[model samples]
Target: MSTIYDVAKEAGCAPSSVSKFITKHGYVSNKLGNKITAAMAKLDYHYNGLARNLSTKTNNRIGVIVPFLDHPYFQGLVNAIILEASKISKEVVILPTAYNANREQQYLQELEHNMVSSLIITSHSLPYTKIYPYQRFGKIVFCENSNHQQTRCVFNNRKEIFEKLFTTLKQKEITNFGFMFIRNPQDSKTTKETFEAFKKIFNHYPQPERIIYNCRTAEDGKNGYLKLKRTIPNLQIVLSESDISAAGAYQARGNSDTLIIGQGNQLVSKLLRFTSIDQHLDETGILALKLATEATSTMKEKVNFDIIWR
Candidate 1:
C-alpha cells in the first residue's frame, strides 16, 4: 500500500526527486539518493507501474497472443517466454486466439492501443496482412519463421526436422510412411519444414501415401485419424502434426502398437507411446521473448529459431 509519496516524505525530499530517481531521468545527489533508497526499503514502497510507464514511456510488460495455449507446443513456448521474460523483469500476457485470425488481429490492436512494450505472436491462421496493424503503433512484432523477411520472425528449420525424423526413422527400419496435417499455412515452422523434407524424400518412384485433412477446430483431430484409417489401413508408419492427431490415430487403430509419430510432443503423444520429434517449444518461446525485448530496447530486426532436432 506504500506509495512513492510516502517514501519521499520519509526521506525528507519532494516527490519529484523520487520520481526522477526512479525513472533515471534526472540527477539526485548521492546522499539524497541513498536516503530515498533507505526510505523505500523501510516503507516497502511499490512503484505504480502504470504511472511509471506513462511517465517513462515504457510498460515493462510484453504482450503475447497465442492460438491454443492448451497444446504442448504453445504451452512450452509460453513457459519458456515466461521464464526468460521474468529474468529481464518483464511480464507476459497471453491471450488465447484459438487459431482465429480475426481475434489475433483484434488483440494486436488492443495491445497497441494499451501501449504494451512489445508483442510475441504465435499463430497458425493469421497471415501477414493481419499483422499490418502493428505498423500503425510502431511496435515490434516477432512472429514465426526466422527465415522470412517480415521485420521480425522465429521458427525452426522445418525441412531439417522432417529430414531428421525420416532419416532417424529409416535407421529404425520403418520405411512405409504417411503424413497427416491440415492444409493450413499458419501451422508450425517445423510442420511446413518437415512436410517439405518428406516431399523431397518421397519424390522418387513409389512414394509413400499422404493423407491430408481439414482442421475443424483447435480440438479437432479425430477426423484426421478417421481419414487415415480409411486411406491407409494397417499403416505401419505415420507422422502427425500434434499429439491429439497422433493419439487419435492410435485410438482409431485400437492400439498403441502403431508406429504413429507426432510433433510438439504433447501429453497424448507420450501417453499413447507414440514416437515424436521434440521441437523444444519452451526454448522457442524463451528465445522469442528475448528477441522481442531486444527488438524493443535495441530496435533490432529479427531473432532466428535454433534448430535443435533439425
Candidate 2:
C-alpha cells in the first residue's frame, strides 16, 4: 500500500528525488539514494510495473503467442525465447490462443495498447490482414511463414524438409505410406506442403490410404497406427507431425520393419529411437526473439533444419 510519496516522506526527500532514484531517470546523490532504498525496504514498498511502463513509454516485456503449451515442440520454443529474453533483462508473457482467432485478436488489441514491446507469433488462427493493422503499435514477428509486408517472419522451409524426408524414405525402399497430421491439410500450411511432397515422391504408388488427421499427442499416434493398420493393411511407412505421436506409434507397432519418421526431434524421439526432423526449435526461438527486438532489413527470414537419423 506504500507509494513513492510515503517512501519520500520517510526518507526526508521530495517525491521528485524519490522518482529519480527509483526510475534511474536522473542523478540522485548516493546518500539520498541509500535513504530512499532503506525507506522502501522498511515500508515494504512495491513499484507498479504498469504505471512505470506507462510513464517511460516502454515495457520491458515481450508477448509470445502459441497454440498449445503441452507439446514439447512449443515448450522448447518458449523456453528458448525466455532464456534469450533473460539475457537482455526482458520478461515474456505467453498468450496461449489454442488456435482461437478471437483470443489472438484480443492479444493483438492489447499490443496496440502497449501491453508489450513486441509480439512473437508462433501460430495464429487470424489471417495476416487482421494482424497487419496492429503493426503501428509495435514490432510483430511471425515464427511461421508469412508474406505480410509490415511484419517480419522467421520460419523453416517445411516444403523443402518434407521433400528431403520423402527422398530419404524412398531410398530406404519404402513405398506405401501413412501420415499423421495435427490438423486438416486445407487448414494447415505445413500439412499441405508435407502432403504435396509425399505425393510428388510417391507418384507411382496408390494415394495414401492411411492419412490420419487431428493427431496431436502420443496416444493419437498409437490410435492412428491402429487405424492405419486396419484401413490400409499394406502401410509400410508412417510420418507423424510430432515425436510424441511417433512414440505412440512405436509403442503400438512394436519392433517392426515399418519405417517411422517424426517431426520436432523431441526428447521422446531419442528415447523411442526413431528418426526425426530436428527443426531446430531452440534456434527458431532465439532468432524470433532477435527479430522481434531488433530491426532487420528483410521482412522475412528462413532458418535451416536437418533430419536427425537415430
Candidate 3:
C-alpha cells in the first residue's frame, strides 16, 4: 500500500531524489542513498520496474500532439520526436489532434489525468490557452511560441526562404505577383513572417490583392487550385505557404508556365516540380526531442530552438 510518495517522505527527501536512487538514474549522495534504501526496506517496497518507473521516475511517457499528422510536415516532425525519444531512456505517446481544440484539450487532460510525465504539444487548431492549466503539473510546452521564457516555441525562419524566393522572382523581372495562403490560425509564426517579408519586397510593385484560400483536407488541393485558377486563371507566379497548397494549384493548373513555389518540401512538391523550402524535418524533430529530454530530465526553463530554412 506504500507508494513512492510514502517512501520519499519517510526518507526525508524529495520524490525525485528517491526516484534517482531507485532507478539508479543519476548520482545520489551517500547519505541520501542510505536513507532511500532504508525507507524502501522498511516500507517493504517492491519496484514493479515499469509501473513504478512510470509513476515515479521518468514516467517513460512523452506526449506529442500535432495539428494534422496526415500532413507530411507533422509526420516528419513526429518521426524526429519518436526517433529521438527512442534513443533515450523514455517512451513516447503521440496524440495527433488533427487541429481540433476539443481533441487537443482531451489529449492534454488525458495525459495529465493518466500521469504522463511530460508533453510536447504542437497545436494548430487549439490556441495556447488550452494548455495553461498544465504549467504546473509538469513540463507543458508549446512548439510555436518561444518568445515567452517558460513556453517553448519550435519553428524555422521564413526570412531566408522569402529572400531567396524574392530574388528568383526579381531575376525573372516578375514585377506583379500574388501570395497564396490560407486565413488566420493557418497564420503560423512563419506564415506571418513570410508575409511580412513578401510585403516588404513587393508592396511597392503594383500587384493584385493577396490570393488567399482555405483548405479543409489534404484533398483540398484540388479545390484550392480551382480557386486560384478562377482568380488569376493564368496565375503565372505565386508563393504558397504549404506544399499541398502549391501542389493543389499545380493540380488545378499544370506548372507548364507557372512559377508556383511551395514552402515545406513535401513529396508532392517534388513530384509536381514545384520549388520549395526544406524546413529540416529531421533536425526539427531532433531538436524537439532534445527539448523534451531537457525539460523532462530537468523541468527548469523552456528551450530555444534556432530554426533555419534550407
Over 1-310, each residue of candidate 1 has an lDDT whose tens digit, in order, gives 8888898999999999998887787999999999999999999887876866765566777888877765566677788888888888887887788778788777777666655777787665666666755755545455455333445556555566566667676677777666666543336554456656765765642233455545322344556656655676565676677666666666666653557767666666666666766667766676677667774443233333222221
Give the CA lDDT, 0 to 100, for residue 92 in model 3. 83
lDDT value, candidate 1, whole model: 0.66
lDDT of each: 0.66, 0.86, 0.66
- Per-candidate Cα RMSD to the true structure, in Å, reads 5.8, 2.2, 7.6
Q: Model 3, 92: alpha-carbon shift in Å?
A: 1.8
- Pairs of colliding residues, candidate 2: none
For 214-290, candidate 3 gives per-residue lDDT tens digits of 54344565565566566665566766667876677667665357666676777877776767877777776776666
For model 2 the TM-score comes to: 0.92
| Model 2 segments more than 4 A misplaced | 171-173, 203-209
What's each prediction's TM-score? Answer: 0.69, 0.92, 0.69
Off by over 4 Å in 1: 1-55, 129-143, 146-150, 167-178, 182-191, 204-223, 255-257, 266-272, 295-310
Residue 216 of model 3 has an lDDT of 31
lDDT of 2 by residue, 1-310 (tens): 9999999999998999999888888999999999999999999998887988876779888999999998777888999999999998888999999899999999998788788889999887788888988998998999888866667988788878778888877897877788888877666877877887777887643355678888988999999998987887667988898898888898888766777888888878888789998889888998899988876776777888788987
